[model samples]
Target: MNRDKVVLAYSGGLDTSVILKWLEIEHNLDVIAVCIDVGQEENFISVKNKALATGASKVYIIDVKEEFVSDYIFPTLKAGAVYEDKYLLGTSFARPLISKKLVEIAEKEGAVAIAHGATGKGNDQVRFEATIKALNPYLKIIAPWRQWNLKSREDCIDYAKKHNIPIPVTKEKIYSRDQNLWHISHEGGNLEDPWNEHDKDIYMMTVNPEDAPDKPTYIEIKFEKGIPVSIDGIKYSPANMIYKLNEIGGSNGIGIIDIVENRLVGMKSRGVYETPGGTILYEAHKTLEKLVLDRAVLSFKKMVSEKYAQLVYDGLWFTHLKNSLDKFVDNTQEVVSGTVKMKLYKGSCKSVATKSPNSLYNEAFVTFGEDDVYNQKDAEGFINLFTLPLTINAIMKKEKNEKEKQII
Candidate 1:
């Protein structure tokens, strides 16, 4: 049994609570529980109490919500890093930030090792370990699930009961969930079965489409470099804006996705995500990009975003490659200043209009009828030059055919 003080990433959930106590008994280590609150809608007082009661020597509840939004979420939004063209990557963005906190707390508390409760089978195990290694290569990582004989949620519950550790998870509500200001994701239980459909009860943040209001809700989003700054002409801080949008978007049933995604760990998992604020924010940012970004730059950025999403989702943030991608994404956002008006009806969000001072869309030149700004006659020479290779190949074929006939 290792007797070094270990810092555990605690969320006040069943897995974390159990891990806290188990670390004490199994490793004979003094556990320092650190909770990074990224606006996940939880009671801190309760979580702190639960941690102390479960054998945590101390508890550190850090409020990183505003930083999570402005520093992490905004950068990814500007980069347009959506994984698989469907996921907004709410969970992906939060992982690194949480892991960064772990590194800092470990150094301050004089702990030699960092502990986490991530299961061996999930992407989070990779995320936590990768970030810890990247930040401080010397620090030891204690992944209990990988080292322990505990196999399932049932085993964990039984262990928790045996030790008198209060756990939130039960056999009935067995869904594994992660929530933040950006989104909430649900997996496990029925979601483990690919054929099982997500019932209405699985979702928390958004209303069901059938249960949504009859009237459509209209709102406008303002942006500077793809970061949302305002809603309906009212300016707000990054955290406040996102919080407001989540409430408004949730009421309209604006964000819900059921997908079977390929995990980085070489397995496929099916889950449902509720990302109300993030959904509207993504739509607004994309609409503004169309108005301002040039054709070639826009297409190339799409390619970059694909790579960026994979890097972030697979847990490679603290590298030089990700840093270079950040520079490219930052350069494009110089002219991404704009506002997008949208209509939210049922579970759908549609852009009514988009405008930007740096817009590349020239109405006069693109008009079909009688545009003096564009010369239609110029197309004759352009098409001839563009088709030169094809024209030459055809001429060569004809001359070769005539020579073959003469020889015959």
Candidate 2:
């Protein structure tokens, strides 16, 4: 009898490798491992060999780095989105793109189902499943972690060794990691305990503050529609720009965040993330937005940004509400075109100067020692009207207190 094929989103990690073997041994399903290269610094050639060595009938390595940066990273950057006000949405950003490719490959190969290594506890599972539902609801999702009896990484390690599948992780060192162009995240292991301090060795994309050079580096970023277009006036591709920023920012320990964040799965998980490029871009973008956006619109976007972050962090990326919010964010970016100069040193990035074509700042109105902009006496009328309600409330309270004293 001919076996039905399943396309697995393979990472060559212990969990996915074990799942690949288990899917074959237990379900009799022909497995095709697909790895999308999104600048994760992973060696896909060796991963392909390992997948094939472990009984995958075929292995497909798709170079999705440019697509990942251009389609997903830029759009989120344009929207000025930061999940939970800290995470640059690094790990969250890769899931939908990877799942989208999985669906495409599955359809192309006429595969009956798609599978992933995302566990029940992490946000990636939700992100992957939501993408699958949105893109190809017909495909059956085989989530082994949720269904399998094996409950821990130990079980996975045992299974991988039993099946003779090669993987990178070991019992001695186990930190669940998610990597992409924008950032790299470290979780599990010592990170499983919220109180454990992340050692300096755990940082992948940034230097330790103690180890960073005792000097500052300067940077200038050009933006259009809130998307960074250049570095120091030198135009670069989206990926190139981020890569450059990573080098500069990482050298100075500019973007490292350790937080025990609330997962969409109803648990708090500790994560140490290195997001050098994303950190710099966020600062630069906000500085420019300050130049162009009005106070009210900027403040309103802050509220909407919280909602957007919640939706993205919660795996509601494919929902209508997210689409509506994206529309709102995109509209606000119309005038958010500018350039910002920043200084990065010793784990700090601060904006120093900002300019925009659509800047709302008027030197005449803002000057301290001004002559022709307006008369100083005009403020008396404006303040009197503005204080009317407060003044009335105070007078009424005084009269009421006086009447009470007389009655007493």
Candidate 3:
């Protein structure tokens, strides 16, 4: 009898490798392994061969770097969506794109089910399942970590050895990681302890701040309607721009965030993330907005940005609210075209200068020097009207106290 086929999101890593073998040996399902390349530094050829060797009927390696950057990264960047105000949201947005691809591949291959290695305790499981259900509710979703007998990473390693499957992680150096063009995240192992200092050796995209160069690096970023277009007057494709910024920003120890963040699964998890390029872009984008956006719009957009970050982090990417937020964010970006010059020094990136053709700043209005644009005395009338309600309330309180004194 022919077995039903399931499309698995295979990373050729420890968890997925073990799942690939388990799916064949236990469930008796023909697996189609799908690996997505979103600018991670990995050998795709080796990944494909390993998946096939582990009993996959076929393997696919899709290069979605540009699409991931343009569609997911840029949109999040424009919304200024930073989870908990520190995480640049590198992994949060990547899951939806991956889930979309999994659905596409499953349909193409006529697979009735899709599987992933996301654990029950983490947010990625929610992200993947939510996106998959939103896209195709009919397909069966398989989450091995939620159902499997294996209790720990050590068990996974032992299983891989028992099945003769090669994996990169071991009991000694068992840091679970997810890498893409935008950033790399490190979790588990030493990171499980909140007080444990993050090891400098775990950082891949950035150097330790202590080890960073003594000199600062200066660079200018150009934006086209809130989307990063160039670095230092050199225009590049979306992926290349991030790639270049990562290199430049990494050298100066720009983006390394270690936080115990509240997970969507009702638990707090500790993670150390390296997001050099993303940090720089976020700083530049916000600085440019200061030059172009009005005070009221910028202030209100900050609130929207927080909401957008929460929505993205909570795996509500395909919802109607997310779509409406995107429209609002897009409208704000209309005047966000500009260039921002920044200085990166020892783990800190600060914007030094910003200029935009559509800038709302009026030099004459803000100048300390005497100018025809304003008269300082005009403020007296404005302040009286503005303070009228407060003054009346204070007078009424005083009169009420006097009445009480008279009765006494």
Clash tally, candidates in order: 0, 0, 0
Error of 2 at 326 (Å): 1.6
> What lDDT does candidate 1 reach at residue 224?
83
Model 2 Cα lDDT, one tens digit per residue, 215-254: 7899889988877889898999888988999999999998
Residue 48 in candidate 1 has what lDDT? 95
Off by over 4 Å in 2: none
Order of the predicted models by lDDT, top scorer first: 3, 1, 2
Q: Per-residue alpha-carbon lDDT of model 3 for 1-408, expressed as tens digits?
A: 989999999999999999999999999999999999988899999999999999999999999999999999999999999999899888889999999999999999899999999999999999999999999999999999999999999999999999899989879999989999999999999899998998899999999988889999999999998999999999999999999999999999999999999999999999999999999999999999988988899999999999999999988899999999999999999989989999999999999999999999999999999999899899999999999999999999999999999999
Stretch of 10 with least lDDT, candidate 2: 308-317
TM-score of each: 0.97, 0.97, 0.99
Better of 1 and 2 by lDDT: 1
lDDT of 1 by residue, 27-133 (tens): 88999999999999899999999999999989999999999999889998899899988999999889999999999999998899999988988889888889999
lDDT of 2: 0.88
Clashes of 3: 0
Which residue runs does candidate 3 get wrong by more than 4 Å? none
**Native-to-model Cα distance after best TM-score fit, residue 53 in candidate 1, in Å:** 0.3
Tell me the spans in candidate 1 whose CA falls farther than 4 Å from its real position. Answer: 1-3, 399-408
